[model samples]
Target chain A: MSDARTALYDDHLAFGARMVPFGGFEMPVSYAGILREHDAVRHRAGLFDLSHMAQYHLEGPGVGHWADALTVNDVATMKPGQARYNIFTNDAGGCHDDVLFYRLDENRWLLVVNAGNAAKMWPYLVARADGRRDVKITSGHGSRALVAVQGPLATEIVAQLVDADITVMKYYTCVETHVCGVPAIVARTGYTGEDGFEIFVDSDAASELWRNLFERGSRFGLEPAGLGARDVLRLEAGMPLYGHELDESISPVAGGQRWAVKTRKAAFRGRDAIVAELEADTHDRIAGIVLDGRVPARDGYAVYVGDERVGTVRSGSMAPSVENKNIATVLVTKAASVLGGSLDVEIRGTRHRATVVALPFYKRPTP
Target chain B: MAQPAGLLYSKEHEWLKVEGDTATVGITDYAQNSLGDIVFVELPRIGAALKQHANIGVVESVKAVSDLFTPAGGEVVEVNAALEADPALVNRDAFGDGWLYKIKIDASSMPDALLGPDDYEKLVATS
Candidate 1:
């Protein structure tokens, strides 16, 4: 394994987890099993050691306008303590990375980026950040750690473990408070589609907070989930991954994230190209396909629109939590991107029928 | 978990139980453990001739798709039909009702060799 150790390396080792190199970090792949951990998140709650994701804090007199220009989403109207799901694109209009921009204060904000692209994204942001805009980029990947606690009853589970009113913070809002007397940033945001909170804290105190929270929340059926469960949960939730569902060659509008890309604005990195491509309605698209059987079509499996080679499956898995069927997100045609469109994937040598469905296979029930 | 005695194992983590010239084949406990949860299994058709290490079947779990290899060169006689509706049986009782197929051995000792419990155990430990 070429990846380095995170701050919670010892904690994962203590839990008897299988660690593997992911994006240059020795991350836990699974503790018990992928299905068991997936079940833990579906039935009750699961805690994830998300300490590997990169964090950047930006605050200044002109943070909103500066940050809004950097990302595709219009963040100028966002209030303090609110967060937006956004993405950054390269000069070719290809997605640089998908991230969440957290507005911590009037001038302070936190941008959580994908782990593998952090080193690439950080320097890109630094070079892109015009000092005249009065924006300062503070890299916190080494200083901060994060955990995602998610499930149907995630709010009550977190409520029992935290002293702050995290339950009423509303979705996409975060509040800084203490958990077991450790200062933490509790944000009501998650990729699991389930109601959940993400806790961001300093590196020195992260392990202790993870241990205490895992112990206190265990009674609520919380399992210390790893990357395996995280993949399944987020895939079920229909969230886009950095390398799988997107990359430098893929367009963000293809993933139903065109809302995040503001066209009326003056210009960002990929503004001109994206605006032109939107007008032309180019060649690629991202579609959700639910398989007929349980065999998960792998990453590179070819997709055929009735014998015609249309596209390829990107991320796929047997969605045991939803059904025994294999669910996948594939890149297909703009003309054939409509929901209920029938498609087939070549699983080994046979083509299996699959239907394009709406995202987030399972939605958390409101309490 | 200890490898169940009397079950002939394959290097690919499949187990075989011999009864006269007819042998039952299924994925071993190690295979199930590595695959996480078994959701589906695609079995070989009856009377299909298979050589040792041939891809006669495929096991689908939550994480991956693994090909089921044959232990010996033989003709597939019967497939465990229970897998179509309930493939999870492979994970629940891999050595018992979870057996995938039965093949008629071509010779006295069959065409190829199967790994013993000790050999299989070492293979899993290292893997």
Candidate 2:
């Protein structure tokens, strides 16, 4: 299959971004280097082109009721203009994709899904709405573009471009506003641990908005970050990636995302299986492992307790912000995931000592 | 892009500086540039023996992990201990202070296919 290109493809090239194939798209993995971009997002602000993510508009009478039945989160309780993180789980309790639901109104809602799962999710949604008469789903995958400005100074930098008073906008809330004279939706949400805003605009106006942000945000140290930095930032923040921390074989409870899975309200897909698994307590759980050695334990490396193979690493990195720390998130047996417990991570045939720690390796300080 | 003269180059991008059977090995500037922001490097033990083109160590960048290959067969003589604390030296000065280790070469076991500076440059250019 041919890889798709985002609207900011040329802009990334002009900025000297190193391109790589990701999720069937030719995306920028890094520009000014991963460490520099990661540091920039932590210290100041960083701009990211997230246009490759899938966006679907679900609108009609009683769409909110239909959405509540479809996702694991309590979408019915969310007020208009509010956003919530959720997972679309299958009947077997395995997560198909972790999604963000934006309640535009009582009759309109938007679902932002992972890029790789967009095609699969679209068909699933269509099949689920087969008998419903008051709902419509339309994909805006390539028609729209998303730019995320993330960091400590992200709000200030974004405030300079948009006319809305974003200071009053709470986290996980979005507002319809004009940015750089273009109609857009600005949300105070981010995958990084710091505060930020994600702006959605038309594909044709994406380059102009990106350039304007770069030009205006240069004073605040806003650099263009790529997927490489995005990975590190998310890992540092303890956010789960789709293929890593979640997949068809991993349940939401095992993935440590039970907070987003609501089993009480009427019914939802995978609710029975999730509740059963919660009651059984037989599933493997996710834990944070800090290696004593410098060599990082990469994904798919084996985790062991004594000579028994316990689990596999889901995501691991030499966290840029954390000095001399090699951290990884692993799916280990429940018995071995206790805090302060010692385990071994085998990297290239060598067993290195690792300690199980809290979920997030880094958390932003609240002012 | 700087392949210093008088150094032997391996197809794997390592450079060897040999003087009286003692050879100093380090990854070339091109290799370091390709592997951006190296955070950690695991060097071979001082007394370990290595074969030509064999995996002798490991180098890790934030984005990926890579194996370090020895360009020639030898017994490890000295490993760069400074890199243990600061592996970015490989990125800052790959050809100088970033030299990985020194190996005592076996006279009869030297590899015959080591590239010269000009040939190594051409190889990298085409690659």
Candidate 3:
């Protein structure tokens, strides 16, 4: 099948972005350069087209109670205008997807799923919501667009075009407002670990808002960044990517998202399985690794302790934030995940020395 | 841009410039551009013998790792040392300062698959 194109497809091409097929969509992987774009987001601001992510519009009084049962987080207690990270799991405790829930209002919410999981999640939600008369789910996969501005200057650049005083908007909060005269849901959230805003608008108005942001943001050094840079940024920030860090075979507990799993809740999908794994505490878990040299540890590479293979790398990148060292996430045996543990990543048959560090190889400084 | 004149090109997107029996090798501009920012380049050690069309080393961008092939085979005379510190040179000037290595070859036995600048430009254009 031909890949789907986002609303900002032309905008990406205009910026000389290198496009690649991802999650059934033709998305830009990089524009100027991964490292260059990464640097821009770290020091300045970077514009992103995240329209490929599936946005589900949910409404009805039963939405909260319904979602709470399906996800690992407490959706029923979320206040309006709040956003929370959540995960849907299967009976085996494996993740369906790692998603963000934006509570737009008491009876309405927006759930954003990974682009690659849209096909699976849409049907899953439809089947789950079939018998519920009060909850309604609408797929906004192609009709809406999500644009994000991330960096230290993200707020300053986005606040200029937004109608609301986003300067005071707390992180993980959303507001319905006009941006560049277009209706949008402005949320103070991002995956890059930078202070930022994600603007959600109709597909038709996406180009206009993107162009306007670029025209204004360029003056403040806000250049376009693509998925390649986003991967490095999210990895450095220790964010869990759906496919790599949390997949159908990897549960939230094993994926290092134990904090998001609220066992205190009455019941949820995969609760028993996840709780079992949590109590067992013997499952392989995700760990942070920094290579000793310049050689990059790629996904699927074996991680070893002397002669015994202990794990496999899940996501790897040449981190620009962590002093230009190579950083990776590896799902490893419990013993191999100890902080400061010495491990070796076997790349192309040779073992490279590495140190197991804490999650979030790079953390943004508090303002 | 047209492929630099007088250089022979390989289908793998590498260029070979023959200076008598010593030939300089590097990836074509198209390869570098497609690979994005090159962060590391693993080149064959000096004195290593390589076969034509064989994987000799690797070129790594931030997102990917691509095998570097030897367009023409022989004994590796010298590998670019500067790339150890600055692999982005391959992205900056792939044909000039970014030349990956020099191989001591039998000029008369150069592979027949090498294309001229014109053919290379066509190859890149279609690619």
TM-score of each candidate? Answer: 0.94, 0.97, 0.98
User: RMSDs, each prediction?
Assistant: 2.1, 1.4, 1.0
- Candidates sorted on lDDT, descending: 3, 2, 1
Per model, the share of native interface contacts recovered reads 0.87, 0.87, 0.87
Can you tell me the DockQ of model 1? 0.71
Question: lDDT of each structure?
Answer: 0.83, 0.90, 0.94
Worst 10 residues of 1 chain A by lDDT: A358-367
Q: Model 2: residues >4 Å from true position, as ranges?
A: none
What ranges in model 3 sit over 4 Å off?
none
Error of 1 at A183 (Å): 1.9
Query: Interface root mean square deviation for model 3, in Å?
Result: 0.7
lDDT of 1 by residue, A209-298 (tens): 888878877888898889988898888888888888888888688766787787877777688778888899966788888998666788
Candidate 3: pairs in clash: none
**What interface RMSD does each of the candidate structures achieve?**
1.5, 0.7, 0.7
TM-score of chain B of each: 0.92, 0.96, 0.96
- The better candidate by TM-score, 1 or 3, is 3
Mark the 10 consecutive residues where model 3 chain A has the least summed lDDT: A273-282
Runs of candidate 1 exceeding 4 Å displacement? A130-133, B108-113
For candidate 2, write residues A318-344 as lDDT tens digits.
987667599999999999999999999
Candidate 1, residue B117: Cα displacement in angstroms equals 1.7
Query: Which CAPRI quality tier does the interface of model 1 achieve?
Result: medium
